[model samples]
Target: MFTKKVVVAYNDTDLSNDVLDYVHEILEMHAEIELNIVYAYEHPLENPSPFQRNYDDGAPEMLAYAEQIIQKAKNRFVDLPNHVEGFVYDTGPAAAILSHAHDHHADLIVIGNRGTRGLRELVSSVSRTIQTKSHIPVLTFPKFVQEEFEEEYHK
Candidate 1:
């Protein structure tokens, strides 16, 4: 299917930036795409209550950091013709990303693979979980894979 709306699960890591690079290359080809950059922050100790919506002492700082990450990611696409937006959610990574994708009726979800080795690879990382649960297509490559491909292509 044609990709017009895409949700990018960004965490501000170098690996995450690689995913954005891939999106940038895709945007060069398809400027009609609308991009959504999302960063989900879940408190490791506290599970948010659905009704209460309470936060621990560190929640505010964590939320602020997430906002910053989203902003930085958005800035990278400033010159692009595509419509771009940023979102910071205080929720589980996979759940928050999937919710945003579903709400936006995204055609694809772009993410970064950490390239976890051995048992870690078998376990569910955020990228793997999103790929398994998302209804739409999910595109991802290992860390630095985009840069490696670009180097080869330019040669």
Candidate 2:
């Protein structure tokens, strides 16, 4: 019986929806534990590290996109238990997620594996860092889980 809080790192992808479904299932089985849905954003600083800065210097546009994504997620899971809280943070995805989990004292962190392959996977520094640096348990759902869900639904 897992009693500690559970945090789900939600993006606006189908993979995120699958993770939410898994969280919902866990909630059904373990009603006592708290749950939180967190969405990460890439923040902008006047003098960001070279690697951290985006080409457009469009922090406002990025924040607007994040808000849209978060709103969609909130609407999708609107009926979650009151203990569940949704959060939006303007920090790099991996750092924001890890920090939120740590700050909230979450027992479990859940996210979707984006299924980056070959060269794509090698270039994903943030994802690799998160996997290595997280202090708490992190669970990643396979990318194909969404396809499986779609197939089941269509049948």
Candidate 3:
């Protein structure tokens, strides 16, 4: 009767891909697990590039990109017996993750951490905030793990 409802707060980062692979490995062992793969994207306030003519144009593109990432993750684990759902939100990553976990009653959250500093701190704060504010368990992958995984994959 053991079960786990996991929320993987994924971005397009390499570390996030590694985390997804780890979750896939786990699912190979325990089939009684469910995944809510959520992606949060924040639109930059800056003016659009040559391709994007307006702010509204960029927002839809960002949402589509986020959805694509979530779709790839879902496809990877589609053969599993458990359920897998993908969600995309315009809010901050930490808030989106926490809200999704709470609403879905997830047992744990898996996030990729780069252990950043400087300006990156503003972006990386999502991992830290999830660790602090989440009522459920949180698992984070460090840069070292990402590097090792990358090295192994390239070999």
Best by TM-score: 1
Clashing pairs in 2: none
Candidate 2 Cα errors over 4 Å, as ranges:
45-61, 125-127, 145-155
Model 3 poorest ten-residue lDDT run: 51-60
Q: TM-scores, in order shown?
A: 0.81, 0.74, 0.80
Q: Which candidate model has the greater lDDT, 2 or 3?
A: 3
Q: Which lDDT tens digits does candidate 3 get at residues 66-91?
A: 88888988998877887888999888
Which residue segments of model 3 deviate by more than 4 Å? Answer: 1-3, 43-53, 118-124, 145-155
All models: lDDT?
0.86, 0.77, 0.84
Per-residue lDDT tens digits of candidate 1, residues 27-51?
Answer: 8788899999999887645665765
State the number of backbone clashes in model 2. Answer: 0
Rank order (by TM-score, best first): 1, 3, 2
Worst 10 residues of 1 by lDDT: 44-53
Query: Which is better, 1 or 2, measured by lDDT?
Result: 1
Ranking by lDDT: 1, 3, 2
